[model samples]
Target: MSTLTEELANTDLLWDVPQATLEFLAEHSAPRTLASGEVLLCPELENGHVYLLLTGTLTVHFGTPDSPMIRELAQGSSVGEVSIIDDTRPSAYVIAKETCRVFPIHRHLIHQLLAESNPFARNLLQMLTRWLKSNTQRIVSDRMQIWELTDQVNIDGLTGLYNRRWLDNAFPRLLTQSWKKGQALCVLMVDVDNFKSYNDDNGHLGGDRALMAMGEVLKTTVRPYDFAARYGGEEFLILLPNTSLNEGVAVAERIRHCSESKAVAYANEHSVPGITVSTPLPNITVSIGLALNQSDSVSELIAAADAQLYRAKMDGRNCVRY
Candidate 1:
């Protein structure tokens, strides 16, 4: 078998290191053997030494040892260097992928090498720079994936509008902002009038087209700062900031008229064979309930608007109520 200094000379991190420095490192550091699945470093634990892999493979995991691997280290790779350099705990778990041999260089010895050996310092700095770049790219990729997933979760697939889940998460923040700024905030509960009867007459597909058209109308009718979301089947909600009771009523009337005049185009199910035909569906109307924020509570504001909606539905539908 070769001497420890000869073994150290073959490793990438120790390459070009002077013979005396290698001899000193070999004399001070000891070789450690780890079994498969052994934890070499953990985020919650302090690591005082940098490890140089001499045989087999190791893996880095962010959350736990059994979690998906974030990175892999080969025989020439080094681990636990960041913790020693920054005097901080490890940021992730390093595990032995299989039976492996590593040389554990203590922090004091690493500092000595940095001060005494120019080649060792240069090699370490190069390794750290590469690691930094790799980590930055990984963080950016993760953020993009998280944003995509959040958008998918918060949007309604059928109407391409914000869903109830998004509204629930956002309403409290909007309410807080209004309270802090002392600005008026209004809530509108808009419901499709005679929706069940319309569904019975036009079938589910026609009803779906009508709802989609209604969604487009709301998106275009609301102000740039206003928020619109699908509250539930056949119902939608809108939030208007910096608006009084009068302005809220005016906005609600606009939505009601827009819904009443809008005609949806869909494929006629009764079209003749071998030819497709497009037909305009009958117009649909909406009953809107408006309420200004008086209680300074999200649930209270929504409840007040919902109560007005019930009144609108009771008073022969197709009208705005406050």
Candidate 2:
């Protein structure tokens, strides 16, 4: 096996350096062995040396040691360079992914090499540039992943509308804003009329398509500032800010009308092999219950709208009740 000096000579940081310099670095640096899962660096602690990975792998984690790793450092990769360069605590945790060996070059020696060796300075700069580029790409990729995950968590899969989970988080904040501003807010609790019968006749797939169509109608019909979400199975909720009961009722009527008129087109699942057929589903209607915000609490507003919704269902479906 190669000695620590030989490994140092092959690293990007010491490339093209004189043998005398490499010998000096080896003399000053000490070899350290790390077990798997060892924490090599942390944001809360200061790192005084730059570590050169001689064998095995290391992982960089942004948050905690147990958090998902953001980057992997293989053999020939360097660690703790950023904190040494900036003279600050490490910004992330570096942990050994497996049993590894590293050469730790102290900060004093690093500064000495930077001052004395032109090649060392050039190589360090190049290494830092590559590190920065990779970090930038990783950041962009992570952001995109986070956005997609957030969308998936908050949106209903069948309807393509915001799900109840999103509503639970958002409705309280919206209600608070309206209350603080002393502006009117209305909640519409909408449900599909005789939805079980429709599902019984057309099957669950058809019911899903109908819900998707309803989602689209709400997306197109609601004002820009209004919020809509799938409350639960076959039930949806709409929030209109700065609107009175009359305005809420008008919006509900429009939604009801649109739902009644729209026809959902779906592929016939029972189609014969090798032949595709598209059919328009029978039109559906909605019962809407509107309640203007008279209470400060989110639960109270929702409860009031729910009561009205029950009334609409009792008064015969397909109409709005306020």
- Window of ten residues with lowest summed lDDT in model 2: 1-10
List RMSD in Å for every model shown: 4.1, 3.8
For candidate 2, lDDT tens digit of each residue in 97-125?
99999989999999999999999899999
Residues 167-261, candidate 1: write the lDDT tens digits.
99998899889988999899999999998988899999889999999999999899999999999999999999999999899999999999999
Please, what is the whole-model Cα lDDT of each candidate in the order they appear? 0.91, 0.90
TM-score of each: 0.78, 0.80
After superposition, candidate 1 runs with Cα above 4 Å error = 1-12, 15-31, 43-48, 62-64, 88-91, 172-182, 261-281, 297-300, 307-317
- Give the lDDT of residue 29 in candidate 1: 76
